[model samples]
Target chain A: MIEDKNQQRTNLSELGEFGLIKHLTKNFEINQPSTFKGIGDDAAVLDFKDKKAVISTDLLIEGVHFDLAYMPLKHLGYKSVVVNLSDIYAMNAKPTQITVSVAVSNRFPLEALEELFDGITLAAKEYTIDVIGGDTTSSQKGLIISITAIGEAEESELVYRNGAKSNDLLVVTGDIGSAYMGLQVLEREKQVFQVNPNNQPDLDAYTYIIERQLKPEARKDIRTLLHALEVKPTSMIDISDGLSSEIIHICKQSEVGCNLYEDKLPLDPQLINVCEEFNIDSTTVAINGGEDYELLFTISMDDYDKIKGNPNFTVIGHMTPESEGIHLVTRANTKIPLKARGWNALNG
Target chain B: MIEDKNQQRTNLSELGEFGLIKHLTKNFEINQPSTFKGIGDDAAVLDFKDKKAVISTDLLIEGVHFDLAYMPLKHLGYKSVVVNLSDIYAMNAKPTQITVSVAVSNRFPLEALEELFDGITLAAKEYTIDVIGGDTTSSQKGLIISITAIGEAEESELVYRNGAKSNDLLVVTGDIGSAYMGLQVLEREKQVFQVNPNNQPDLDAYTYIIERQLKPEARKDIRTLLHALEVKPTSMIDISDGLSSEIIHICKQSEVGCNLYEDKLPLDPQLINVCEEFNIDSTTVAINGGEDYELLFTISMDDYDKIKGNPNFTVIGHMTPESEGIHLVTRANTKIPLKARGWNALNG
Candidate 1:
């Protein structure tokens, strides 16, 4: 990454903190009337009118959360912003603005920072969210990205994880395990590259899974389509910790149990092939592999008729009384008690 | 730290994401009515009756912001929360709530986390701000702390850095340079201890300065006292970036000039004594030393009479015409142009 040298560059100290802020944010027009004031005071002022606000925050570290070798700065920056937006979408709200703060070490050149900001600016444009305000400082080790996204929605349309009741149908958006399989594929190729840097990564066939991990999209459209169809989920949570883990969260919070069918667990063909090649059970991967970025929700049984056959969603299970406990029906007709073994299995 | 037998014994995977949140926040109580929902939903919900709300955030890294070797987890936790609250005070608003999210490695024992939360709980009690919501995940490396503080104030009551006018007097709360001296002392002692662990550090004389570094207080009282005395700052910013940089910020933002007097610079006696011992200039430390966490502001000439001899403040300078630029009248009876070395000066 080469620094931009054509324009006259001013040292940050030349303008001081306040001047630097004003200079950098000069062109940042506040399109949202909700932004009462931005970047002139100790904090930005927000006005949401009568609508309630949905707030979510996420932290992404350089070495821990991502690797600069394979992960492009643009993609890393884009993913960091999208991750927080997914949380807002999960709440069924329209993300309007965000505050992005970065802590970086001197090891990164100024050109590297520009690349990072390029991705951030691109994502901000795509999301139609104004970059309101944030603090930037130096870190001791790697770069740290912390984002706080603010969204808005009517009080009645909001969703919570504790709203599920007995007999509600569980549904999942898109497919599961692709992102996890993608991660595996990347790691294997990385090892291959480490052993021989000249080895070309055979990523053409693994495009679908790799894209899942590198650029997973938020289910913001799912919320819009459901609203258009007049179907509200009884309870919903994003599939970040895998389907089994998220399902357990809904069940525990809603005071209900569930029985998911192993045959109905959705999987991409490429992902299944990759899992098979790795000698891991495809079912285990679907149930436990994380970072899917899909939506897992529970809808009332009466409303299930609206989209039971919809190509975009899959009906996997139904909630039962809490005392019954959660279970999984296998293809062999044997029932297994569902315990949250997603991440714990990997750790042990 | 030692590991806690009871709490430390449970694995994070056992609780998963949702369960971990519920288990950790079980002891936390919601004291602010504006905090409609917290922790369980995809996003936290905030409902405020006021027309506008103030939001601010900060990130504290492991080594750059703090040293784990000497700084205890409890103080780190306290300092993180206070830093956000200080920003709210700078806006002349009372902090009502905060969302704290942290990521740390498994190297930390359960007792260490408890000690960290112990300080958070204590700060909540002292500041009367609710710990509303947060996200927690396993970090790959060191500890990372991100806090977003929300406060309420009328549009007219809020202060802006652009509000300063010519002839306004620049004032700072408490003293400066002590925190910088404290850091030097701690660093020196750390080097000594590293050479011989068995040797005891005779630090009784440097106790005050060390505490100033380890546990700096935000100028929360200054805002309240200013309100009580019926004096409002024309423009304000917290002094986390040293006095020289802060003065430059006010001048640049307000489009005015300033003239500071070297004799008027405030310094704790211990800071002066230690600076002398270290063969360092106390004025340099006062001008460029950071992490003071004090309030720096300008007041109009009309209100100057009310705050002239106040023990809690020092009028270090006065605003001048924009063409005059910022100047420092040296003790040698010469006017010298002021330069803000800022945080970037560390490289020199």
Candidate 2:
């Protein structure tokens, strides 16, 4: 079925690296004051009043982490940076700098590289983060992008997975499953096109979903909003692997349990429509869909009033006693134990 | 000729990633005191009392940058790290930590990845550097490694390529051309193996030469040696892309020029022997061979006697006025201009 879309494949060389980076990261916003210089110079610079910093790096390779046949390098670059930034945000730190390392084959002309760089530079500009330094080299085939992101926060502001309390409230920003639906739609269209080259993809209806798959932004705004409200998350993490998987991480690490209501799951009408079209259970998708770069946190009951009515956030669940275990109450009034079907690359 | 060795090719799967990393960096040494951690952490933690930290990264891929059918992975990993570390060292700072990202295809079993990481971890331990964070991803094909090394030294102690002064003495650490000879020997053996797979490689005579190629270490000690003797290099760099190319960097950045005497060029007897056997000019190899991870620096005249008889160093020549240009004196007294024949991947 994938063959149906073979004709739709476009050569990446058409877009230069710089142009691609620019196209992809056009909407990003920088919310951290510590983000001194981002994206253009040889390296991004960050000045910190705090003493400690956390840095992490990741590499995504074509065919392995992605299929360029499906991925646009511009969007790929944006998603890649967002993925790493999620880790920094999860640690309650403000991201300030990033370094990108890319390896391409000679099969690709200079234009393809510039496209990749275009996305990088755009992300740098929008995130107000610097592209401090990176490695550029030749690959035997396909392409590899390695990114390192650095973040800083005061020692007091940093939140760890172990900080969740038994009675704290659990919340997630934005609606979930949209990004996952986006991927499903893209994959379906890809397969559809393979069978018939002239078949135009009915992409207009799936625009939002496809965009979610192609572009995911780090929730830098949540940090600022929470700070302005004078509330700090007892435990925080970005929904990367999936809500269930991340909830389990916090519960396991904090030795607490939680109870979430399926009906309370935030839903974007478009996400629901796509799930209906794809014959996927919306509840399941919302719970288990990964790559939703949204913030998930537990707040003290006293701070609830400050955030409860905010349109940008949803109170998806609340913490339960350890003995209650992490359970989900379905709309049919059935209580089921929560489980993880999160993306675990190593195990797979 | 490259195809002839195909029959004898050792599948990378045999070694695994961890095993390979161990094999390559088994002998590197850590000589700087400022290194807080060297290899084995989320991120290399650094403590520079009063310095502007400098970091640089470089990536190397198989088939494109290196012909692994002849180039060993151990050497590849070692050389890859050296190239990046050399950049940090070139800034006249002490390297303290490094992050390594690798992308490999499934054709390689897990063992091959272990081999690569083994060498990387060993290199970290030897250099007293901590292995911070890195990404391990699957690639479409071949192997790719991107390394980012972080280093720091006092602001006054830091040296840049642009700091070279007119009349400063040019100094080099260790001998050169051996690594190039090593490459020549390996290529020749690869050719021989292609003609006959069963014919064992007679490498007894090329032990030192091959070691130079497969296991070149960054000259971490040079910084300390100079400091201990109360001598600071006005400008410094590690010899990676060959002597001529490096001199050009110093000249262009420092806005100065110099004369290099061919007679004063340091070549070990083993290097001389191989040059004669291969019928390649030894001096040419020294100037253009590349992959010699030694330090080249400029020092003041008053410090000459301090390092004159040190076995680990060589006083090659002196820097002259800008108009003198970069000239290399021949053994027979002919003065000719030096050209940059160092590695340029764009052209390659």
Candidate 3:
């Protein structure tokens, strides 16, 4: 990815570990008032008076989670931060700080790492979060990234997956299956270009799906929107795994089953067209596709009046008693048991 | 490493991601009072009313940080947790929670992971910290572990490396250089085993140093001891990258010079014996050897009388004006400039 003819290609060893971290993080400025100290210390210090601190972590490996041939290092950096922040947002908390740890082999140039940090800096600035502390080390093979996101919220405002009860209405934000369709389009393009290196395939029509895959954003606005509408979710989770898998988690944890409707799944028109072109089922894509980064929650029926007709939300179904099983009601009125066909890294 | 002849070898795929995490973390219990929720949730939640939160992170890569040929999985897990907690303790804070994220290749069976978790659980129980949140995914090459430790302390009690002033006495807790000598013993034995597979390493004499290398304990008692003595340190850092490197860090950050005495460095008697047997310089081993996990701090001269005769504390150096520059005074009274020969992963 470091193809700049006019730029210098410096090796990482010249800077050393401390010098490299200082060089890359020099531009990051602390913006959060809760952050007492950021970087340049054994640890970062924060003060969240009277509020509970929420912490989440994620690990992303190169060949397993991504392919460098098509996935740019900058986008990978941005998405890594986005994925961790999605977990904090899923708790209905405001993300305040993040720590990023990256391990890279000697194959990567200093400029490549700079590009990756550029994307990370952009995400931190856009999200108004502080880059607190991190560790940089060498890897024997490919790149490995780990991010820990810290947030804060009042104890009473926090939501958990076990809070969902029977008769709660299931709701989801934004559209599904776009990211999966986007991956399909990218894979096809990759195969096409592999056979002929000189080929430049036209991909103007797959713009939406491709962006959904590479530049997915965490739902940072959902918590504010719900608060503004005076509606509180009984339980919530981010759709990192497919809709069916997350629904099953909420159901099993809360001791309640749910009836998910097939017709109510929100899908972008571009995704539907791509699914048809690829000869894939749209329903299957929506249920099993991962990395959407959307929010899925259950709200009590009393708050249904407040959320009804909201463009940001779609009421997919209602929860059932523990005696009933989780089922999907098809457009043809046929009932089928829901299955967790989400992506599994180990299984693959 | 998993050689259970009576038990069936279960592949990681059969449990999937969620099921694997649930099964592995089922035994983890929240023992810290600051922890409100642990595992299961999107993010772990904690409450630290008026105390400032301290957070630190570290990454350990196979072949770069540890060699699996000689390192056991259980010791690796415990050392990983201890390394992060050392950073927290270096800040003069009480570590209360941690999040561990691991990426492993398919070669690792479910039973192997259980052994790793067993070590992590032991650390959590011993340190009285809660195992909060984490992510587990498949890697392409080797195992990688990332841990983030969270702690709390009063704002006034926190110490940074930049706070040292002239005339402060540099004190270190416990002995150093044993771990490095222990590593030399292990590497030698490994080579012997490779040449003759029937050779058994008699490690009776190297027990103390070998334990120090594989199972080093963080200086968790130093803070309590300092509090009891009413001696607040001006600046502090953990000795993970050798004593010379850590001293250089404190001197550079605090804008002061230091005079470290060679004869004052605390070393175990067994370390001296091993150094003589290997024909290596004892002072060089003590200065450049790493992974000691001892606390090196600077305290005011007024507290010297209180800590002078204590066996747990050693005055190895004293801070001087910035114009003097950092130097080491040998036993022969010769002054030489100090150099940081700490291990650099990138260089390797």
Candidate maximizing TM-score: 3
Error of 3 at B104 (Å): 0.9
List model 2 lDDT by residue over B1-348, tens digit each. 222222233555455443344443344344455444333322323344444556676667777667777665555666677677777776667677677777776675554554556567666766677565566655777777777776765657777677888889999988898888888898888888789877777788888878888888887877788779888888887787789988887887788998898888889888898889877778888888878888898998888899888988788888888888998888888888887863342225
Clashes of each: 0, 63, 0
Instruction: Sort all candidates by lDDT, best to worst.
Output: 3, 1, 2
TM-score of each: 0.91, 0.84, 0.97
Lowest lDDT sum, 10 consecutive residues, model 1 chain B, at B1-10
Cα lDDT of model 3 by residue, B1-348, tens digit: 111332646899999898899998998998888898889888989999999999999999998998776778888889999999999999999999999999988988888788788889888888988899899999988889999999999999999999999999999999999999989998898888779877767898999998998888998998898999998999999999999999999999999999999999999999999999998888888888999999999999999998989999999999999899898899999998887863442134
TM-score, B chain alone, candidates in order? 0.93, 0.85, 0.96
| Best candidate (score: DockQ) | 3
DockQ, ranked from best to worst: 3, 1, 2
Stretches of candidate 2 exceeding 4 Å from the true structure: A1-50, A320-326, A333-337, A342-348, B1-51, B66-82, B342-348
Expressed as tens digits, the lDDT of each residue in B245-317 for candidate 1 is: 8788789889999999999998888888999999988888888888888899999889988887899989998
Candidate closest to the true structure, highest lDDT? 3
What docking grade does candidate 1 earn?
A: medium
Model 2, position B249: C-alpha lDDT score: 76
